[model samples]
Target: MTFHDREEELSALTTAFETPDHEFYVVYGRRRVGKTELLKEFCRGYPHIYFLAAQEAEERQREKFVEHVADYFGDRVPRIDGWDDAFEYLGEKVVDEDVVIAIDEFPYLVAENDSLPSYLQSFVDEQVRGTESMLILCGSSISTMESEVLGHESPLYGRRTGQLDVQPFSFREAREVIQYDTEDAIRSYAVTGGTPMYLTLFDYTETLAENVQSKILSPTSVLYNEPEFLLRTELRNPARYMSILESIALGHTTPNEISGATGIDSGPLSKYLRKLQQLRLIDREVPVTASAKKSKRSKYSVADAFLRFWFRYVEPNRSSIEEASKIVYENTIGPDLPNHVAATFEDVCQEAIWNGIRHGMFDQYSEVGRWWYGEHEIDVVGLSPTDDRILFTECKWTAEPVGIGLVEKLRAKTKHVRWGPESREERFALFSKSGFSDGLEQEVDDSWTFVDLEDLEQMLSAGR
Candidate 1:
């Protein structure tokens, strides 16, 4: 719940405030990504009027907004009839002192009134252009916010002095809040991703199983119903969307595969996948060695880690959990949780590798992602712009230390990866749950990096 890691966003807002003229900032992201929290944090040391808009009549929202304006300016609540009068009154208040007027859920206002952004464009140009006061438009609806506020055709597009896309916290930032031990913490991140709101729901003192049993599996808990509720709230066809997500989480990645699994036609399935992609609920991935636009091997996966966890464990076994909650955890999810977490370990290692690049531990990477050609698959591939360095990693979430044989097998996969020239230096990284054996340690060289669970933790900690 406490604010951590948004210094970059905070700094951007602060810099905007320090600029000489009036500033209009478009701040946006998906719901529960902490846009509101970041905005509130930036407004902490300044005189500001924070107005949260809602789904209501334009008159109701205007009335509420004017009241917020009135409270900030120490004036009586006026019976404002229109946005023109509201802007005029607000303009008068911002003339002498700098006061930020942040409209949270700005898209909601546009939803109620289509011409609201046009009205804002005129207001900023005529009313607040030369004033020191700032205006921030924040929204949870990513598509609505971008198209309405930041799109080229939008009236308010060129008017914005700055924009901030508030993203979910990184795994490192998530770890700061989710203070479990290393293994459990990774499991927790696999469940929650990096969303601030979701991270707060976890209690570090409790074991992973305890949290899953109580926070997610229990019928009354928020997480138990989260993915279903979120889809219903965000998408018009919730049942169909749920089916598609469950299919992807279950390992049906391609369009035809998903269609066969869900019985949805590929034509309509594409639209659903596009919508989910736009909402950041699903991500489309091509191999690291291939161009995404032209690749026929593109695969779609659930982007939100928690949604993946929900669809995989909760959605499938809902009936079993309803029948017996305690038995369900021990019998169903508990046994398979390790495998679930292991699936996510490759991503965690890639994150650490990127962090390593930032801190000079790893060579520079122009692109880092999974690469697969036919039956050959490389877990993590980091390509360099320099053409001199290419890194391939194999992640093993096993109980025992990785031996030289496994490393050599990973080395064998590198020959199939066709990116740089054959002479290009290919480096290998092995990430393991337990560690590397003494025999494998002898094989470590300039081209090889061994990352155990603790070493991975420390690598992530570098940025934290």
Candidate 2:
């Protein structure tokens, strides 16, 4: 709950601050992933001046910036009209030690004045760059930050000493935020994502269904309009973005399908998708070894669980939210969530299995992912990149026992799919919630592994 897994980034930032010379750093990420929180936490005990940029006229923003500088300096300070004068005054005011200046939502500041970057570059080159002060620029829009500020052609391109793109908390870190079973934790993660704002809404003590109803189903809630806020900030056309997001939520992943479903031209859709991917709202994936730029088999998905939930349920139920109607919202969202959560649970199970493999707990797989060819889809597939060894697995979220019949079905589904050189040497695995049938468990040969929710839970607990 308290800054999990950010020690490395924080240490780097600390080093930048402790250096004898000036340090300029850029911190960017998708919205609500705690970029500002991390900076504020790091600012503790330091002589720091923090100012957030508001979407306002240039003159008003300058006044706001001047007021913050005056407050940080303590008492009635000089009146300044522009950033250049305020920065110059700070240079003349400070005598000894280091000063930390953080500007949150720096992109918004740049938008207010297109020449601000050049002005800052000139100021740093002429004055601020020679001092021991540390200047940090923070923004939530990755594309704008990277292009307008950090891009090679930008005025401040090489002026910074460090750059940090802080991603969401990992699944391991997320588990500590709540105490749910393996499957339930994954379900929560998939829906809430690793976003601190969304994760804070989850009450681990309650059932998943209860949490959903309490956090999301209500009329006045923090997250009810989250998707809208994020979309409107990053995009000019919220309707077009919603269409693409809804299409992905409804199980369309390819560009062709998304364009076809949304009626947006594929050429223009690419821009929207790229922006969303930069914000971490969606993800574009290719086969593990595929080329980074050109991979025909690449697919896109709504990577954020809460975004997916909103697209699948809340967006479709817009009328309900507007009309303050609960009957339609609950009845529609209730039954569908389990199936959705169950599929996501399998993805979490696979992620857990990969973590085990990484730590040398499992020697079977060197690579793991979902495999599909035509209509044949394997929920979980692990293949050894070295020896070409392969493992096929099926994950069941039901309470009923997983009988040998399920295994037979897996075998049948995989009949046309060959594994390495010898099919006989291939391994089989079953992951279940209620676990395998007793007789069926006895029937499996030594070439298979049977793991249930309890096993996964124990592994996670031990790892923690």
Candidate 3:
């Protein structure tokens, strides 16, 4: 499990360390997203002290913190009575030297003592400021990190030198971790999403079905109840959140539809939706061409691919899993898994396309996302509002080569998209898992870009 990507984040942290001024950085993301690992990697070869806070009483946590500080200093440090005392000890030890003091799972400490942030603010202002010490506060609770640490009313609002919201790896990064062919790598990513922890658990040598059965369907597996564990950790009402997530996974995307399926009122449902969105468990999507603020047609979908798979397959078949029924994996999961992967493959292709856009491989676009109108849906749309140009894309995740008929179908849908005037210049791109047909390759000219597995592998392998 070597660190694969995160060059940008590592670079930013290295820059923070190089600066002479004291730095207070807030880093937070969901569990197993590598926040702590990222900090540990940054602290390597440097004079740093990392303290992981546990879910314990305030006094107990302070004693542990004091012990860690003492160990770092190699001396008999006095017992810390409070956070202020702890930070004071830290400030004295790293006043002149470039030292990193990272507190992992910081929200656990905040939960024990509500006034921890204010104490931290005082410590930053009176002790750490103007020094070469860098204090990195890390947490997994997105809501707590947002409302308590970086919120407008937070005590340490203006005190932080920088903030890093670490996210899961993209498909390209995931490929580096899961060593497999391009098609199989895509399938593995569909199951693990971009989460490094889950990706590492997958045995690439085994068949996808075997891996799914052993690593996911088994009751003893680490990922068996992973989504439940995360929900319980972050939310007070885990059952309610689970119901909402299950509804979305079952294709109940609209508010009314979800409410109908879950038997929850729309008013309370909105709050649950907002909370889940804040946690990054689900996302609300409007049409790519529509204004986000004014768009009335919004669909909710599970944001994490692992959670999507869990809710769709595992959660519903918990009894079968407990009973060790092979039929559950072979009949139910095995049959529908490819279709699920197909949907996720579209997302991966969109990400690959976005990477191309960032590298100036595609025309400049103001926005890019999935677009739909009535019964027509375009997989990917890159819109350059100023230039009156739009790139409509279709992603096919099938074994067979995509033919010209699919391109024709995509072209027919493009005419219905109303972004600008009818004279708007249009570009078309197609991504296929198994390359394209000869007819498609010959029919398309310079305006059309056909991206297959080989092209995608090349784009992903550029920096490898």
Candidate 4:
């Protein structure tokens, strides 16, 4: 509903606006990811004119632009008929003072007028090259924006000075917006992935069930149709995209698995994957060290939590899901969600370790991530980027105490992973939701840092 984050983006835009010369900047993101809001907020106080390109023909668009420029110019606003004239008039208005003129949904304009970018670029080269104004081209269609505006061969290529690929709000910022330690907060996060527009539906005071029933399950509510809206905006064939996304959500990560599950061939599926990846709705990742740029090792997953939730529960049971009542949906989501949450919890732990090393919480380490060799996979890997020192950790989300045998197994697994012969200084670490076994705890006098969930909470709380 309101801007709760993006201080950094706003600051960057502010600096750009205050800069000299004819500044051409582009801001793009997936649809409904708040690209327009960021631009609007950044352009609020300045002498600015905002024009959104629509799906109209070039002539109609030109007329609308003329009307908008006319409005800004008041009685003296020129009766310009073409985009070139409109931009020229805009250049005239801000000849002396620097101004921000934003054309939101710029791709639509380009679609309507294929030569729009070329025309603007030509206008800038001829009349506005030396002017003191900023032209922002903002769009939600990521692929089209990149190809049409920022591509190397694009007509507008090498013209724009800055570009912002606006992303969904991070988990930390989302937490700030809804500061609750309850399950509802986690569920809301898992459902929305910090998209401000979607997260606003979550009432901080209400239970997760209440929020879901009121906002998501209700036929008249905004969330009930949210998936369709997003899917429609991002893809041409919503059914195919929905199938691919649901397969990934259901744990079919590999191309073959997704294809098998969705009954789509891998050849056609790759295109969908690319589109989804470009939209930032899903991620295609390797095992952190997989060599091939695109191979079978690459696994696909829904990158946004909200999209993941939709695919996992809502999309799969669209035909008969609501008939089962809110209680059934809640229970179904409840059981499998903690496992997903656990994976994110491990990610948080990895970040904590990195943050710790940055703030002197640990003496040494370089890299950290999921590490594996053959079938043995370790959750945390801390390798000294500066030195040969390496640390391996197994993060667990259980109440049971991690015993010495688990450490021994991890040590054995490490043997397969290469760390050079001189990597004798390697140490082992464990992060647990519960705590360590007493025998293992006594053994780890100073050789390791046995961190429990409470300890991590304390460390995070101290902001060290």
Error of 1 at 303 (Å): 0.8
lDDT by residue for model 3 (1-464), tens: 56768889999999997897899999999999988889889999588989999999899999999899889889797967778888788778877666889999999999999899998998889888888889999999998898888998999998899999999988888777887888888888888899988988898889888898889988889999899889977988699899899989878999999999999999999999999998999999998999888998898999988999999999988998889747898889878877888878888878877778777678888799998876889989999989999999998888799998898898899879988888899999999988888776778778899989889887656545
Taking the tens digit of each residue's C-alpha lDDT, what string does model 1 give over 359-414? 98898898999999888988899999576689889999888888988977887888
Question: Can you give the TM-score per candidate against the true fold?
Answer: 0.96, 0.89, 0.96, 0.89
Query: What tens digits encode model 4's per-residue C-alpha lDDT throughout 1-464?
Result: 68767888898888887777778889998777788888888888788889988888888888887777668767455677677777777666667667678889988888777778888887667765788778888998777788888999888898888989888875545667765662345446776676778788778788776776677766678877787787776567788888888889889988989999989987998888888887787887655434447645577778887777777777766656557647656677667767766665676577668767776777667556666555777888776646667777787766488888887888788776676466456777788766877777776557677887667655454452
User: What lDDT does candidate 2 reach at residue 270?
Assistant: 95
The runs of at least 3 residues in candidate 3 whose Cα sits more than 4 Å from the true structure, single-residue gaps closed, are 462-464
Question: Over the stretch 155-222, how does candidate 2's per-residue lDDT look in tens digits?
Answer: 99999999999887766667778678776787788778778878877788898777776687666777
**How much lDDT does candidate 2 score?**
0.79
State the local distance difference test value for candidate 1: 0.87
Order the candidates by lDDT, highest first — what do you get? 3, 1, 2, 4
Stretches of model 4 off by over 4 angstroms after superposition: 56-60, 182-184, 292-296, 363-366, 399-409, 422-424, 434-440, 452-464
List, in order, the clash count of every candidate structure: 0, 0, 0, 4
Runs in model 1 lying further than 4 Å from the true structure:
none
The most accurate candidate by lDDT is 3
Poorest lDDT segment (10 consecutive residues) of candidate 2: 416-425
429 Cα displacement, candidate 4 (Å): 4.1
